[model samples]
Target: MSDASTNAGAGNGAAQTPVQPKMNILAQFIRDMSFENVLAQKGAKGETKPDIQVQVNLDARKRQTEGQYEVVMKLHITNKSKDSGDTLFLLELDYAGIFQVENIPDEQLHPFLLIECPRMLFPFARRIVADVTRDGGFPPLNLETIDFIALYRAELQRRQQAQAAAPATGQA
Candidate 1:
């Protein structure tokens, strides 16, 4: 057989072969959730008190992928007294979902999963945090809408800037 034909056959051989695999949401579960409304009761008592501050940080991680991916949404929330600057409470919640992705092109896969999927999950995760806080006894913590796409772009720019500013390594 000619070399060109032999190479073409080898390449086509893998294309015709079918691999057995399944794409399914094996489980969509909350890995962890922590809630603390330290001043909820204090505030609910209807007494005039010091001002309180609420801060939130959202994070995510992807676990080992066999056919599907387990994506986690981690929330770091804190409450503090604005006047005295004392920490009232701190809570970290990690919620996760098992997403099945198959037959998705590589170019579109990242934006779909990273941007779209996370956006879909954010509200649910936000609700859990807000409800937990309100039930804990303080004022309901209504988290502001986050723009993940903008945040991602800014983060990428920052990294590029940092890399560009760093001195190149070479022997003197």
Candidate 2:
């Protein structure tokens, strides 16, 4: 076989494959969680369609250990009655993960920490929401799949807008 075809010679002109990035979930935990059954507290509920809203936020910071980062996913869920406009339940959760990442470019690392790390931690966070709602005397809340790439883009846009407004507000 030719050296170029077999990639067996030092002088071969074949482009080398890029090194694959690596990430490891060293630990995951729930930093904080709260569930309030407002419907029960008010003692007023009878077969109303629930209007549910979920808000997710992500934060990441570097750890002392080399190539290690801590990412936190914060979830705020509110369920209100469609008929009465009263709150049914409120759930707030902060889930965090420690990840060891390697071989990723600095430009991409921020998005990877906010998007990919939370993507890995999502199932566990979803399950916790389901369990918490069910245990709190309501039907289980099965969260829909999240699009992390979109979330990351939205966050970038939000920050850019905020920065634009900051100078205008400062001048006011």
Quote each prediction's TM-score: 0.63, 0.89
Q: Give the alpha carbon lDDT tens digit for every residue of 1-172 in model 1.
A: 6999999999999898875433454455567877665655445433334443433333434556644666665667777766655556666777676777676666755555555556767787778777877777656666777676876677668879878767554322
Clashing pairs in 1: 40-137, 40-138
TM-score of 2: 0.89
Clashes of 2: 0
* Local distance difference test, candidate 1: 0.63
Q: Which residue ranges in model 1 land beyond 4 Å of their true spot? A: 1-26, 37-67, 165-172
Please write out the lDDT profile of model 2 over residues 1-172, one tens digit for every residue.
Answer: 6856566655344446567999999999999999999988988756989999999999999999999999999999999988888899999999999999999999999999989999999999999999999999999999999999999999899999999999999999
Q: Name the regions of candidate 2 deviating beyond 4 angstroms.
A: 1-16
Clashes of each: 2, 0
Task: For model 1, give the 10-residue run with minimal summed lDDT.
Answer: 52-61
